[model samples]
Target: MKVFVFLTLLACGAFAQQGPQCKAPNGGGLQPVLEEFVALIPTDKVLELVLTAMTSDPETQAVMEFLSSSEFYQVVDLVQSQPAFKSLLEFACSDLYLDAAYYFNILAGIFGFPEVHNQTRAAARTAGFRGLLLDILELIPVDELKALLDQKLKSDYYLQVAFQKINSDEFGSIIEALQGDAAYNNMKNRLRGLGVDVDLIIDTISKIFKP
Candidate 1:
């Protein structure tokens, strides 16, 4: 009996030294658990919940009102009339911009995101300012004036320099105007009412994506 007890103790020590077996059971993994979780929530129900939340938010209403206001159009006009803005638009319509976008799409393709590459190519070619500006010109009766200004803007170096200088000096005035606008203030206050800590959200998102 003593010899049997000693042999049993020896076997137990050997098993402990060999370490725990970690073989997963057949058909057991994270895939089934994820499927089960997804099955618990219907897609339509999820959409309904998100839509309800957005519609109930006062900030959403405020944003809609601000978008429909005359002040918004005035602000757009002011920005578009600036020389720096026109320069930016000209750059957007250039081939160099398309080349940069093509490189970005290639990088996306390298990362196993072929859809992003395809969408980027489509958007860069069709949805850019070149096409949009042409469409707008066709709709309006300013084709001759637009052609004249386009020629002068492309050829006049001194005019471009003057506009760049004015843009640099008066950029702050844009912010000042927005700050004094009633619709802008109302939208800002409504967004503040959501009570979310913007900095905390940004920090958390940064940490999540940190390498």
Candidate 2:
């Protein structure tokens, strides 16, 4: 199980996302709706799709309307694991795929939870939260990121290389956010000993938020 790092985000941006775009001449290729939520993806190659998505989506408004409370995050969680995602994950598995615990660690780092609700935005609504995602990441702090990295290493050796590029101060914030939690730090220390730089974990989270 390797903890995929921030660099992967840029790659994810470049590739990874492949979903229906617009209604295609006859009103097709829309996001899957079970009643539904919107996740935008463009048909372009080598482009930043998430940024494009935040601007024009209506499902976002639908999500926002139902957001605003406990159920809000719940829905985000629901969306995170939407069965469709299993297929997406399978589609994306080639770049980095970990089985067992490594996969769970990566899942923890992902922000499937919604940040807020009822806040309307006119910015393309389809653009998704590019900046907001980055800002929210600082919200997780440093140590937790380190601990997460450790979990990744325990499962995936290749991730040790990924950990080499992060910055320390950034990682510290995650630790501080964890408030010296024993479990979190224990994981961090273990990873650190393996030469997994705390900075790499920070960089990955930063990218994930922005990605």
Which candidate leads in TM-score? Answer: 1
Residue 191, model 1: Cα distance from true site in angstroms: 8.8
Model 2, TM vs. native = 0.21
Q: For residues 5-117, what per-residue lDDT tens digits would candidate 1 score against the true structure?
A: 11111111111212222111332221122223234434454344334434554543354345345664454445434444333323322311211123223322332222111
Q: What's the lDDT for all of these models?
A: 0.32, 0.32
Regions more than 4 Å wrong, model 2 = 1-134, 139-142, 161-211
In candidate 1, how many Å is residue 1 off? 80
Q: Any idea how many clashes model 1 has?
A: 0
lDDT minimum window of 10 residues, candidate 1: 115-124
lDDT of 1 at 60: 39
